[model samples]
Target: MSVDVITNTSPVIWLGRVLSGLAIAFLLLDAVMKLVPIQPVIDTMQALGFNSTTTLARGLGILLLGCTVLYAIPKTALVGALLLTGYLGGAIAIQLRAGNPLFSHILFGGYIGIFLWAGLLMRNNQARALLFP
Candidate 1:
């Protein structure tokens, strides 16, 4: 794309970066619950229906988050885009299941859109290099 087009997509770029952080924070929350093996953290995730599989959840969550963070960093942004985009997919699925048409749908949908845009932007040679490396 042209410089003008890329310049106008600043919001998308920012959203992608923020989403990377969010992914990290959320997964870290899960990771703390599982990897740390602390009762309190496990209790919390269990309360939220993340019981039994907390370890797997934690590992995947962290792996996904790490991917996004790496993507935000130079030379690894595309992988981050891949990770964040897929993570958002799972997020959208879970949020959709909650069945709150207003809050759940809008919030998750917006998040998905942002990540998708970021992923697409990251696909571009210019945007990818700028954001990732």
Candidate 2:
């Protein structure tokens, strides 16, 4: 059997896919790290005033992973995006409360959020219509 691939492609779509892939990969890695709760992660959590509790970290990790999965699936992507937006907003608030750097720490979440939304906008017509129209 022959495979039917997306043939009518454009640069914007390609960029969207790439951005979505990047966000997914990064979020996946982050979730895994939190689940693992390695030494570095624990330290970072303590630095961020999270009490560095393994249970809490893993719970948060699982939640983030769930959000990422939702964002990755086409049917549930809108809900996933909305969830991730809130998650990223919380991250930004944490960094701000921790007195982290403006650009490197606090704004990092905003940057990733931009990529997530922009990628969705470029590749998904439904998302585009919801956002623009």
Candidate 3:
């Protein structure tokens, strides 16, 4: 296969496969978060001026987890990739805002590099027509 096909497609599929466990774990955390009394988390959210930051966080986590699950389906690879990419973007942005260098690099820089590089190869000629043409 050409680099395009591999990068744009395979990596997304691979990520879905690899993150299956992580997705599940995040979902579990989301559920547990809903059930348990999370005073500290709520307090942090309140302090941050994000009225429902905890719920939003849990919702985003679940959304990404669902996207990961959808990614496992071959036909949905592109959609899954978009979702995961967006999720990582948000994660990167949030980490940066918090001045967390370690996680910022790990979550944003590293994942962005890998995902973007891989996605490049997956784009079809039609998708590339505007730029590459």
The numbered model that scores best in lDDT is 2
Q: What lDDT does each candidate get?
A: 0.57, 0.88, 0.52
What lDDT is reached at residue 117 by model 1? 54
- Model 3: lDDT of residue 51: 71
* Candidate 3 lDDT by residue in tens digits, 43-73: 6445445575556656655675576565444
Worst 10-residue lDDT window, candidate 2: 1-10
Q: Using alpha carbons, what is the TM-score of model 1?
A: 0.53
Clashes of each: 3, 0, 5
After the best TM-score superposition of candidate 2, give how far the Cα of residue 82 lies from its true spot, in angstroms. Answer: 0.7
- Which digits, one per residue and each the tens of the lDDT, describe model 2 over residues 91-120? 999999999999999999999999899787
Q: Residue-wise lDDT of candidate 1 within 60-119, one digit each (tens)?
A: 656754764676565666566666667667656655555546565637646554654555
lDDT of 1 at 69: 60
Ranking by TM-score: 2, 1, 3
Model 2 segments more than 4 A misplaced:
1-9
The residue ranges of model 3 lying beyond 4 angstroms of the native Cα positions read 1-54, 102-109, 112-133
RMSD of each: 5.6, 5.7, 6.0
TM-score of 2: 0.91
